[model samples]
Target: MTSDPTVEPGPLARSSAVTVTLLAPVARFSLRARAGDLAALSGALGLDLPQKIGDRAAAGAVEALCLGPDEWHILAPEADAGRLAAAAAAVYDAAPHSLTDISDREVTVMVEGPAAAELLTIGCPRDIDRIAPGRGCRTVMDGVTVLLWRDGPERFRLDIWRSFAPHVIALLRTGCVELATCS
Candidate 1:
């Protein structure tokens, strides 16, 4: 399938209060396997799998996100998708599980600034203040499904479908403007 070039925009906005940056492309995979299979899975993937909900584990350029009891989302440099998929397939051989490449389906937008969490609270129901760094979960913003994660005390990353990226960035920019005016 061909993606619309017009929908992609660069650096939506920047401010001391909040700076929105479009992240470079990365490989993303959706994984579903039984908890019992984690050991082998981790060994095959060459990265420790996070065992707790909302937890994330990273080794080098690869990171694994535990989205559920038996589900995870893996992110890595675009060049490593094939290798990672191969490892997963080898590990899950004769086992029941699912692994899918979703790299091109979504885009990542990073929000960084002292008011980053506040800007996200405008549409997300989760209390951003409560989500500590290195953790994230699936949530919806303005009805758009997204994976919200805190990368640092003042930095947040939102993973949303490529189609919804523009709308989400616009909302974030609006929030930044509103916060600027309020302060």
Candidate 2:
């Protein structure tokens, strides 16, 4: 898998929006569980789940979050995503749960640096800072549902649907440039 400069760096992709600077190459994994098996499945997987998947990922080790009643989206380093998925499948496959590898189905953008929070505020309405570290939330940004993770004081992970990822990136990039030129 040669790197595609057009695709950005890391496991995420750079936003097409020139205003918002985005980190590249997000590794996305989707976990599917049987009805009523979310707790045991999560416990068996040993993930200290936060109140919300996206919010909890900000607590350091985590990279991104997604939510569903019997499903969750876990984003991490592309290289490690397969490992996590495989581990989960092995442990839960026989336990009446199903885990699918949807790493390629979405786009992940890591927004960081001094202006990350401010940049995100342009698209997200939630009080991002109040979200607390290590927690995630569901919100619409630039007309797309996103999984938001507060990676740090100025860092956040934004996961959007693959189809809408480019639009979000473009908008953010535009915001970044506009903000930069303003200040």
Candidate 3:
């Protein structure tokens, strides 16, 4: 895949109401366990796993997000990968659970400013107006799978696969340009 010039740092794209910023590397873990084992899993990882779909919980720099009844995505500093993985292994030992490291497989982008929601709506089908803070869901933007979450009132984050990062960034840049021209 070609490197997307739109994500080359130093403010790739912006408008009076929207700006897209690429985020630093972060650790990511994909977890799956039965509801009955959630408590144990949480105890093992020392992370409070979110219970409801779209719900998100954070402990310091680590965050646990529920993607489904039995699926969760954990995000933390890349340095914590080993420690977190060890905890998960110990807790799920002999139990029917799966924890996989996906830290290097994805990239995170931050979209902020007043028009952030409108910019996302250009390609994302979810109702950005309806997503409350502390909630997120797996969705597609321009056909690329993404994890969308609101980090603040006018700020949102998109976690996209590494290979698709360029495509998504390009889309965001184009959206920003269009929004700027219209306003």
Candidate 4:
């Protein structure tokens, strides 16, 4: 490893009020289905696919976020990828749908602690405080599209494209310092 003083650790930031960290690897899927296929699809995948945009559903270790009436973003433990994919495909016998594996296309950025919402607002135009826990929506941060999930009043996660991660991290790093200093 190079002894570059400018290079910092992987965590986006960690301070008194908040902790921004990159989540461990997880399997991700972009699922699309017709209105009638929701039930069958959910049964096959073991997670209820929400019907309303921004709604989230969870079953054990799996979670699904409804980004649109016909589209969902699915997340699960990394080792479950192949098994989950096979299950989703089995639905093809009765319900015609699409499930594209997207595990490598993005990474999860988790912002936790009391200042989570406020930190997000640094680059997000929407009022972060309004996004209720258990729900998520497709939004932009610093012009990059992100799947914003509010896990609680003090915890949130942003699913960001891998290519834009560095840019996002830098902005957040600065935000964390500023927030701490301002507090």
RMSD of each: 1.8, 4.7, 1.8, 3.0
The reply for model 3, stretches above 4 Å from the true place, is: 1-10
TM-score of 1: 0.93
Model 1, stretches more than 4 Å misplaced? 1-9
Each prediction's TM-score versus the true structure: 0.93, 0.71, 0.93, 0.93
The lDDT values for all models are: 0.87, 0.62, 0.88, 0.87
For model 1, what is the C-alpha lDDT against the true structure? 0.87
lDDT of 3 by residue, 69-122 (tens): 999999999888898988878866555699999987888899999999999999
lDDT of 1 at 162: 87
Model 1 over residues 68-167: C-alpha lDDT tens digits?
9999999999899999999889977655589899998988888999888889999899989899999989999888999988999999999999888778
Off by over 4 Å in 4: 1-10
What is the Cα root-mean-square deviation between model 4 and the actual structure?
3.0
Highest lDDT, which number?
A: 3
Tens-digit per-residue lDDT, 47-118, candidate 4: 778899989999999999998889999999989999999998888989899999998888788899988888
lDDT of 2 by residue, 1-183 (tens): 223332354433233332233455556666666555655655655564434444343323434354755556666666766666666666664556656667665666778767677788888888877877656777889778988866567677776676677678777767777766766
Give the poorly placed runs of model 2, Cα more than 4 Å off.
Answer: 1-6, 10-26, 34-46, 50-69
Deviation (Å) of 105 in candidate 4: 0.5
